[model samples]
Target: MDITAVNALPYEDFVNIFGNVVEKCPIITAAVWSRRPFVSLNALEAAISEFIDDLPESGKEGILRCHPDLAGRDLHSGTLTRESREEQARAGMDALSSGEASRMSRLNEEYKTRFGFPFVICARMNDKANILRQLTERCGNERAVERERGIEEVKKICRLRLQGLVLCDAPNKL
Candidate 1:
């Protein structure tokens, strides 16, 4: 839909439209719905970011934990959202050889064990090898640092999803 159409959607409709942008974090989209009539994709993204920034540590952790492991259980069980499935497939995750899939599964477990949440990344922005490399390297990061990085990656994913759903435009003059 275009920016104007997006701006005109009702509260629940708006929230539903964007609810999956950050995986299972519908609360973030619900919060953003109150700041409606977004004139540009950036405005919508900023509102979402502000809501996330204001969340308590527990709330942030809940959002992080909502994300699925890369090429993990959801993919095999066909439980991933259509957007997520497409994004992972684009990253060559769907075509992983047995060895690659096994390694990814191992890294996913290690990363989650270390960070207490799934390792989040903008899959559409990286190929499988690059994602695996980063996953391996990031597994060594401090928990706080990894948490922040995951949030940033979530933002990038949200931005790309929003761009797919809304057209960019200059802010409306009051």
Candidate 2:
């Protein structure tokens, strides 16, 4: 899954590898997949940023939909991934007290009701407290702002995940 291998993949194969996430963040995924043998992690990250920068508002919304709800503990098919679930577990979702679970449930409902989508965050490097804190703070953002922010968060997550999966930060050419 290094950059050379990733870039060598057929476009359809690349799309399939990411599953539904590709459709949600096409421009970013496409640019990343198309950029072969990235010499540095920064170069790959640049591609991602450029892709996000060029997306239309509607397309940005599509990208935002790729992320799971912040700290979502329960499995609901289509949403579970090994990496995400592992991160959730690391965040202590498995040991939530009943009261904490209730609060999270209510907060999730309120956020979704207000924003028209679930609250999204890049939980890759975050533990449970970080996720919970973000969920609480984000509840205060205006809908329009949160929508835009959600897309950015997804972009961040994709970059981190892609770095771990594909980029190698080598200086040699592919």
lDDT to native, each model = 0.86, 0.65
Per-residue C-alpha lDDT of model 1 across residues 62-166, encoded as one tens digit per residue: 888988888999998999888889999999988899999999999999998887899999999998889999999999999989888998999999988877766
The runs of at least 3 residues in candidate 2 whose Cα sits more than 4 Å from the true structure, single-residue gaps closed, are 18-41, 71-79, 167-174
TM-score of each: 0.92, 0.74
Candidate whose lDDT is highest: 1
lDDT of 2 by residue, 46-153 (tens): 776677768787666666666566445444343666666665666676667778777877898889888777777766667667777788899999988988888777
| RMSD (CA, angstroms), candidate 2 | 3.8
